[model samples]
Target: MEYFIQQLINGLTLGGIYALIALGYTMVYGIIQLINFAHGEFFAAGGYMGVILLSFLSANGYLATYPWLCLSGAIILSMAYCSLLATGVEKIAYKPLRKSSRLSVLLSALGMSIFIQNGLMLTQGVYDKAYPTIFSQGGFDFGNIKVSYMQIVMLLITILLLILLNLLVFKTRIGKAMRATAQDKTMSSLVGIKSDRIISLTFIIGASLAAAAGIMVGMYYGSVGYTMGFVPGIKAFAAAVLGGIGNITGAMIGGFLIGMIEIFGAGYISSEYKDVFAFIILIGVLYFMPTGIMGENIDDTRV
Candidate 1:
């Protein structure tokens, strides 16, 4: 039972990270049917940015003097970096292909993904970059289960960000505009909502969440690499699909479900087959309930 509880904790932590990345996928697809396959690169870039910033800080002897401050600043800068990178990618790579066929847009997204991955490889190298330890080490005991402080902090940050995001999407004028554009781009433009700007903001918001997840993953795993995002990216996309693509709440629930599946499958079954569980669920969901558990809104135009 203690071991089961331990796996549950681990699953939730992994789920939080997946949920954050899955939001980017759902939000972008909601507004524009483009999958933006390169979205995962934003996660990799943020991880690299965090490592780069921490390296510079360590070299300057500031990491030890102001660990929390430095960590906070690195996260902020990494998120900004990813957010700007996403906006630029949208304008440069996606916007031109907007009027083109879906095949063209999808191919462009795949091309961009390749381009970004290789760029990160050339710049950050293929070697794993270690995240500098700025956090004070400690753990809490729950009976026979022990959870690290990093786990607690990561969960807290995820919850806080989720709350803020919910407020932004549900309460703000921009949020309403986003919903309007997603619902009907033509009518939104008719009503004076700039679909282009809303689309850009959607990418920005998604990229920011991806960045936050990147930071958490880096801090938790103690390492980041150029290819780090690929697996998680695929799983997150599955989560988006599992939760009904284009639905924010669906993505969140899907992420947690996938995470739990992976964790429990590994713990109880075979570690080698852990990844198989998520893909199996994804296949099952696609085959059985194509609309996902949340049921997709089919009225959105693909174009």
Candidate 2:
């Protein structure tokens, strides 16, 4: 039982991170029907930005004196940086190709992904950067189960961000516009909503969330690497598809399910085949539920 509980906690932590990244995927797809392959680079950028900010604080003697404050500041700054970066990418690479063929936009996204990854390599190098040790240590124990402070922190932040996102999408006027735009971009524009602006906002929100996940993952794992985003990005994209690509709630559920499956599969079976298990489960679920666990049939009128 204790072993099960331990694995469950680990699953939740991993799932939350995936959920964060998946939200970016689903939101972008919901708005534009295009997968921003460069999305993962935003995550990588955030991790790098966080490490840079945290290290700067430590050098200035601020991180040791006010650890939490420094961390919070780093997260905020990294999120903002990613948001701006996303906005630029959307405007430069995506917006122009919006009216063009889906294949063109997809190719552009792929190009952007390679460009950003190479940019990161050029700037930050291929070496892995280590995170500060201040927040990664210590944890509460329950019998034979152990949970780290970083895990708890990651979970809390993930939950809080998810709640805020739900409220933003469901309760706010902007969310209403977003929904309207998603349902029919032309109609929404005719009704006075700026589809372009809404699409850009969607990218901004998605990138910011990915940035937050990147920072948390870096802190939890004690290091950030330029290549860190690719595999997680692919997994998060799978999670979005599992949950229903355009559905926010579905993405969250899918992310958790994927995370749990990976953790349990690794725990009980061969660790080397954990990823294989995740894909097998995803395939099985999709085979039965073609629209995904929560996905609706996407028609031409949509997005």
Candidate 3:
């Protein structure tokens, strides 16, 4: 029981990371029906940016005396860089293909993904870089179960971001515009909504979320690599599909559920094959619920 509880906590924390990335996938899909495969590269970019910023700060004496400030600075810089990258991708790679066939757009996305990955690999080299630890090292104990401060922080951040995303999607004018655009781009354009702007905004928002997840993963695991985004990106996409592609709330739920399954499967079944656990769940979910847990919003043309 104690082992189960511990694994549960671990699973939830990891799920939080997955949920953050999944939000980006679902949001972009909701708005444009494009998977934005290059998104994984954005995640990698954020991690690398954070590492570089923090490393520079540590070495230059700008943050030598203030460790906490360095950490905060790294996070801010990473988020900003990633947000810009996301917007740039929308402008350069996706915008031109917006009117093209879905297959063309998808292929373009794939090309962008490869381009970014190889670009990073060439620039940063194909080596695993060390990530700095921000949170204090300690765990709270409950009977035989233990939860780390990192886990608690991750959970809080995930919940807070989820709430913020929900508000942005459902309560704001931009949110309404996004929904309208998703439902019918032509109608949205006719109503004076700039579909292009909305699409760019969606990409920006999604990229930023993925960036945050990258930073969190770095802090949690104390390391990152150029290829770091590959597996997580795939898993997040699976989560998006499992929860219902293009559904915000569904993505969140699916991410957490996937995380839980992976962690528990590792703990109870075999740590060696933990990664396969998410795919297994994904397959299972698709087998039974093709439209995902939330079901497809057929009337909402966005997905």
Q: Give the number of the best model, judged by lDDT.
A: 2
Q: Give me the runs in candidate 2 sitting further than 4 Å from their true place.
A: 300-303
- Name the candidate, 1 or 2, with the larger TM-score value: 2
> Candidate 1, residues 16-69: lDDT per residue as tens digits?
999999999989998898887998899989999998998899999999899889
Question: Which runs in model 1 stand beyond 4 Å of their true positions?
Answer: 300-303
The number of the candidate with the highest TM-score is 2
Error of 3 at 294 (Å): 1.0
lDDT of 2 by residue, 1-303 (tens): 888899999999999999999999999998889988999999999999999999999989999999998988999999999999999999999999988999999999999999998999999998999998999999998888999999999999999999999999999999999999999899899999999999999999999999999999999999999888899999999999899898999999999999999999999997899999999988998999986898888563222
Query: Where is model 3 poorest over a 10-residue stretch in terms of lDDT?
Result: 294-303
Local lDDT at 202 for model 3: 88
Clashes of 1: 0
| For every candidate, C-alpha RMSD to the true structure in Å | 1.7, 1.1, 1.9
lDDT of 2 at 284: 91
For each of the candidates, give the backbone clash count. Answer: 0, 0, 1
TM-score sort, best first = 2, 1, 3
Worst 10-residue lDDT window, candidate 2: 294-303
lDDT of 3 by residue, 1-303 (tens): 888778888889988888889888988988888887888888888888878887777678766588767776777778889989988887888899888988898888888898888888899998888865545367799998988787787788789889988898899999999999988899999999998988888888888888878877877788778888888998898888888888999899999988998998888889888878878878888888877888575446443
